[model samples]
Structure formats: structure tokens, C-alpha cells
Target: MTVTVVVGNPKPASRTSTAATLVAKGLRPEAEPTVIDLVDFGAGLLGWGDPAVAAAARTVAESELVVFASPTFKATYTGLLKLFLEQFDGGTGLAGVLAVPVMLGAGPAHALAPDLLLKPVLVELGATTALPGLYLSDRTFADDGVIEGYSDRWRPVVRALTDAAKVADHA
Candidate 1:
């Protein structure tokens, strides 16, 4: 299956990106994920019809699984993520795609940001969120087993959802 990672961190190769990649790998080890760091899109994100940005959106839309990640800002997801998400159509833009929202923060205060804020947007874009959103501590994510544990519990659920979506398509 095709898995895609979309990082909304402003920094090109930020820790958020790394965590997102790791999450994608943990979810489906065999899949070589397509990592799209929005920073690479540069100023194109501000305008419309940019080939690279459109390609990235298409890649995510076509993927079987996708990790939409960003660092928590003011207790919410970054505006950068919002900009990228706005590229997709309001409904059915991500049809048949399974999305996992991930957010990293300095403290635990905004741990619910992913579920409360990001997940809704993904749902509105027509993606199925089969499991709880993941929240990681920006300071300790690398050494923590959060991703592993989450994968253990939800990977199967993700697989099931994917299978169900496929079946629905054929029916």
C-alpha cells in the first residue's frame, strides 16, 4: 500500500518531519512512504496552480494511508498545515484515504490538538480516521515508545479500515 507523510513544520527538516516519517514507518513498515515537507513548496503554498504543490496534494489523495503532522502552535496546528489542507476540495478530496493526525508540543497541555483540531479537517476532506490521533512530546519523541505502542494498537485497525474501504468501492 502507498503511505504518505505530510509535515507542516516551517523548518525544512524539523523534528516534526522526522517524527512523522517514523510514524508512517511504524504503521506500515514495508511501505516506502512519500514524505512531503511543506517547506519545500516554498512561496507556492500562498498561490494557486503550483505544479509541485498540486502534485503533493494528489499524492496524498491517492495514497492508501496518510499521516498529517504538524507542531502545535498556540495550542493549535500551524497555519502552514491549514494552508496545505486548504488546497484539497472541501468534501471527498481525500476519498478512500485513511488519515492519522499527529501533533507535537512542548508540553502535554495541547495533547488533544490533533484530535480536536486536525482530525476534523481531515474528515471534512473525506478521509477516514480509524484510530485516535497521536500526540507526541516534541522534546522526547525520539526516545519514546509512543509511536510503537500506537502502532501496535492501531495498525491493525488501519488495515481493517483500508480493507473495508476497498470492499465498499467494489460493491
Candidate 2:
């Protein structure tokens, strides 16, 4: 399966990226996900029709599964991520892709950010979000078993949905 992880953190190689990668791997150990760190895009995200940004959006659109992750900023996702997401055609750009929203916060106060904010945007972009969004503590995501726990519970479901999406694409 083609899996991709899109990190909206403004910092390059931030914990948000690492946690997102971990989540992608936990869901599919055999698949190597393409990681898109939005900070790398820099000014490219400001306007439309940047080749690299467009390419990134295409990569995400073609993926079977994608994990959209960001640090909790203002109790929501970053504007950088929103910029990247804006490259897509509304309601069709992400059709047939399965998306998992992930958010990292310093504490549990914004635990619902992933589902409440990120997931809806992905859905509006036409991605199927079958599983609940994942919220990880930025402080202890690596040391904690939250990623593993989420993977253990939802891996099979994700796989099944991916299979279905693939079939629909062919049909």
C-alpha cells in the first residue's frame, strides 16, 4: 500500500513529524511512507501553482493511506498545513484516500483537536476517515505506547478500508 505522512509543523524534523511517522509505521510495518514536512516548502505554500507543493499534494492524493499530523497551535492545526491542504480541489482532491488525523499537544487540554478540527478538513477534502483521530502528548509520544495501542486496535480496520478503496478505484 502507498502510505504517506504529512507533517504541518513549522519546525523542520519536529516531534510532530516523528510521531506521525511512528503512527504510519505502526499501521503498516511493511510499507515505507513518504514523509512531507510542510516547513520544507517554505514560501511555496503562500501561492498557488508551486511545482513542489503541487507534487506533494498529488503524492498525497494518490496514496492509499495518509496520516495528517500537526502540533496543536491555538488549539487547532497550523496554517502551514492549511496552506498545503488548500492546493487540493475541494471535495475531490482526496477522493479514494483513507486519512488518519493526528495531533500532538503539551497536555490533554486539546486532546480533541485531531478529531474536531483536522478530521473534518480531511473529510471536506474527500478523504475517508474511518478511524477516530489520534492525539499524542508531544512530551512523551515516543516513550509512551499510545501509537502502538492505537495501531493494535485499528490496524486491521485500516487495512480493510484500504482494500476497499483500492477496489473502488479499479472499479
Candidate 3:
């Protein structure tokens, strides 16, 4: 089973990335993971027709589960993620794929941003979204730039993702 994550955090060392890393690490051994950082691709995002972008999109298309991650920008997912997702032009969307939306922000007020904003987009992409999109407070989860320090509330969320992955495997 393949599970991939498309991360939109701009910094090389970012909390958003860390959160995704944590999720990837938790996947079942049989569930191989592909974690792609959009910033690492650079410049020709619109040149998505390039071999690399095409390859990455294929990874996304083939994965049984996808963690679509981003550092909340203006209360929504980053443009970097938007660019990467634009590469899925085959009109397949994310059909037959399960998605876990993740968003990190400076304040707790934006906790609902993932569910309210990102989830809809993931659905439009044709992916079945796991409930309660993960949201981490930059202040609480990113101390000294370390995202490994998950908040007390993050446990159940992790379990939810794990459960979803199992369900997707069966489906």
C-alpha cells in the first residue's frame, strides 16, 4: 500500500513538514510512503508538465492514502500546495484515494481552517477525506522549530489517520 504526502511548507525546517513527517512515520510498514516537499521542486511549478512533476502526480494518483499538508497561509492552504495539486490534470481527481488534510497556524482560532477550507478542496479532487483534519498551533506544536512536540490534543487525531489508512487498505 502506498501512502504519500504533498507538503507545502516553504521552509526547509518547518513545523508543517515535521507534522507530516510524524504521520509518515506512523504508517504501517506495508504502507510505503512518498513525502514530497513542494518547495524542493522549485520555479517551474507551472512547467508541471516536466517529468518530475508528472512522476510525483503519478505517485499521488496511485497512493492509497494521501496527507495533503500545508502551513496555513492567510487562513488557508499555501499556494505552493495549490501549484502542486494543479498538476493533477487528468480529471481523475483523487478517486479511490483517501486524504488526510493537515494545516498548521500561529493561532488556535484557525483550527477549523483545515476542515472548512482544505477538506472541500480535497473532496473536489475526488478523495475521501478522513475526519477532523489535523490542525496544530505553531506556538504549541513548533517549539524551537521542532514539530515533534505534538500538543495534548493531537493523539486522537493521529489515531484517526491510522484508522483511516487501515480502512483504505481494505477498500
Best by lDDT: 2
lDDT of 1 by residue, 1-59 (tens): 88999999999899999999999999888898999999988899998999999999999
In the order shown, what is each candidate's alpha-carbon RMSD? 1.0, 0.7, 4.3
Candidate 2: misplaced stretches above 4 Å?
Answer: none
Q: Write the per-residue lDDT of candidate 2 for residues 67-115, one digit (tens) a residue.
A: 9999999999999999999998889999988999999999999999999
Task: Pick the TM-score winner.
Answer: 2
Question: Could you tell which candidate, 1 or 2, scores higher by lDDT?
Answer: 2
For residue 17, give model 1's deviation from the true position in Å.
0.8
- The clash count for each model shown is 0, 0, 1
Candidate 3 lDDT (Cα, 0 to 1): 0.73
Q: In candidate 3, residue 151 scores what lDDT?
A: 26
Ranking 2 against 3 by lDDT, winner: 2
State the weakest 10-residue window (summed lDDT) of model 1: 157-166
Which ranges of candidate 1 are over 4 A from the true structure? none
Q: Tell me the lDDT of model 3 at 86.
A: 79
Higher-ranked by TM-score: 1 or 3: 1
List lDDT for all candidates, in order: 0.92, 0.95, 0.73
